[model samples]
Target: MNRIQQKKDYLKQSLSLLRDKFSNIPADKSVIHKVASPLRLEHAKGIVADAILKIMNDHNLQMLALLVNSCRSEVVKILNEYSEKYFKELKWAVIDEFGSVILKLNTNIATHNYLLPPLLDDLEESSESSDFYAKSTNYFSAINQNLLKIVIYHWRLFKNATEQGYLSASELILKSNVSQASVSNFIRYSLEKNYLLKHKIHNLYKFNNNCLEDLLEDWSFYYKNNYGKAIRFISYDTTYSIDTLLLKVKVLRDHNIRIAIGGFLALELQKLNYVSDIPDIRIYTDNIKYTKDELDLIEYQSQDDVTGRKIIELVSPKAEASIFSHIMNKDIPICDIIQCYLDVRHKASRGMEQADFIKKSVLL
Candidate 1:
């Protein structure tokens, strides 16, 4: 967080970005003009020495001096090549963290500008630039997931205890296992936000008319924002009708495999009639690995040819099912509308539109 630490993170990120950018290039290729190109660093690629000099000149002089002065023998040797004045760009330079240059630069360069390029991101979510949820807009924010967790926990508890017992704030703290300070803050915030209502008889707490829905949305968005990559996309050889999907799911269900359709499939289940290139069938399964036999069984049962099937790792399969309704009387179960919305909200395709429509018509 300090000036020096910030700069170190910046340098590391920039170096990492360059490494990722040219990851496709052959490591042992002649693109590198190393004083002695080590096998490990043969893959290194980035702006040429001239550009580095340009970067050095454009940036702080003190940091560059320290970079040069603190160089390890290898870095010194690398810099030795750049000792001579060069004007034009060098095609492929070895911009690797080969030596202790990073540590040396940090120790020697006392001060540096923290300005740097954006960091890399996960594949699917990073590609999505939707304003659908406004999670990043900071409109409705939580310091941590604790608030949502506590609220959902208490809501479920209240429902279970409605007949025999009356729940109070003290009991909530005891049940939540959260700190007293945090508990008090959450209670106050929920009350102020009209999410919680106090029972007149025993001062028990319950959700306001729409509090439960909002709480679930917050929870889903939290997972979607933090763990979108888990929603793995798959292709199916053939388009599946409701009857075929039902059969496929029933086969898995009979085997006790936990499965739920999400993404475009869920939209179809919800009767949205949304169509796609191959009908992105995203299924959340608890099973880490599936057998070829099981898939073959599904194929035999469904009789619907498919191109591909994408798999998304579920954070909490049981929890998701508990919050959403299970498809009725189907050979297999499908995720309720809420889970479907969460699954596709972060997708890069027409995912936002699907999620939004579901949220408005089904979830809300």
Candidate 2:
């Protein structure tokens, strides 16, 4: 049978097993909750374990099945351990039952496409402070605690950065209440992974904009022009490594003209007092160090703010000429005439109309 039929059959079998277990319990609401709660807790633990198992199986790591199998038993033992050692007032059995039901519902949805009927009812009862016994269960409590920590950390960092000028690595450590070593490791890892870039000025770090732009350009190009035919220009920034930039260029080599620029540097240059020519692009190493300039020619506007005047001048137009001269200097060889025409047309429509005329006259 097909994949759909196979999935449906598997789901049917699982649901049948679940139904049998479900029917054994009493039908009264209070009695049902009391009995099914433990089952729900166990089942939730099982679902997480199963998901882990499926991932492990896919990765050929099924040797860890022992650890996976111990999940439910370990959870139960831990609950019991806590109850016996710490608090006599804690009702872990109820927590376990509620968890099992939630887990069963989650797993059913995941594996069998079955929806839970009691979720809304449970949520309603749990919403009220008077229903603290119903709401403050271990499973939900753990999830809430972990989720809150993550959300709060992210929110606070985001707020601090936007409200304040910049957040340093040390600042992040203090704000996060994490160790300096841990923060250092995180920063190092992020830098290595190209997730963040460190500005050399004051050791300030920021999210990598070049990576984000490249991702956007890639998605846009793929969706807009699937065919490997024409030149499309993509704007990338300084955060990209030479390798990453090259890979993106190669993907679009057949049909794209990628424009590399120091996006952050460009924005920052506007604030600088120096009238020095800004390089068109800046290349960075995996270690986040500026290695060498990729492009030869650099250009910039004059310090004098002239309206609608040609205040900007190319610093190394000859260098630029040498670069493009290698590509376009020669007459289009006879064999490449047709391809050249198409290339010129594509580039022309993309605002290189002047190049189209030059190519047609020189090549034809």
Candidate 3:
């Protein structure tokens, strides 16, 4: 069979084993809430375990098979009309593994596909309380920058929560700007690596015992490690004096060019006690033609490696704006402290030493 069929078969087998357990599932609202809790997928496992029990006892397993395939929504609609009105109250769902998630779906994302369900329902619920999931912790990854941005937006959520040990997939979806399936994958990674714990809450997750300091340290490490693709030198030119550099800046500015001084030059312009023999004249800009033609830059074919003291032009690897609100030398506009710090972090002979000094002196 194809990959989708193979996955389907795997899901069926897992469901069949649990088919008989649902026969005596408790009907009490409290028990049902615990079993069908949308906060975490684990709680939904009870539904599947009960599904297996009910399926085995019945001769007509057609409906049960559909529910087993993650098609919970359709099953719920069908259950509503079934002769047994009690079935309407039954929360039938499937619990299986897809990527890092132990999926608990009472419904498939769609009837045509056999994949996991979307977290739209939970998303609606999240609109009611956005702060519950963000205060104590934030999710950031070296592998995904978009997800990192989403986490950054919600980082404050963790700080506000005095005791937030459980996070649901829906909260994660909204917080991370990721889809339900993506949230499941990341949760699986967090759980397996022990960053989060699968707690008592049905669909919620718990911490795996790492203390606050350790968690913060790991996040810091990931941030620095994945600050992502190093500085890119798109074009460069040789100019010997600070006066010429200022003139070039004036030219770019006169032409309505958006540019900002960065790297060691920014440090020097800031009047910080930074010592450098070959101070880099770095400028961030959207337009490269003006500088390349205006300054007569010798094209350096190598994109990964190139340097120039007179002038170097770069565009952000992620298309981030070159915000130059800070003015360092009265007339010369400079990039923000963070941008300047990164620009020289890995460049020049004494770049690291300067970066350290800049970080402690300005950024700290």
TM-scores, each model vs. reference:
0.40, 0.17, 0.37
Candidate 2 global TM-score: 0.17
> What's the best-to-worst order under TM-score?
1, 3, 2
Cα lDDT tens digits for candidate 2, 1-364: 4423332333333334445645432222211111121224465444334434443445432111111111234444443454345432222211211122112222123212112211112333324422433332221122222222232234334644642444586777655555676556556544543435677878866654333322222222222232232111123233444345445433333333322222112222223212233222222111111112232112333433332222111111111211221231122101122112222233222313422343334321
Model 3 clash tally? 28
**Local accuracy of candidate 3 as per-residue lDDT tens digits, 218-237:** 34333344445423333344
Ranked candidates, highest lDDT first: 3, 1, 2
Candidate 3 TM-score, true structure as reference: 0.37
Clashes of 1: 17
Predict model 3's lDDT versus the native.
Answer: 0.45
| Candidate achieving the largest lDDT | 3
* lDDT for predicted candidate 1 compared with the true structure: 0.43
Candidate 1 weakest lDDT stretch, 10 residues: 62-71
Candidate 1's error at 51, in angstroms? 48
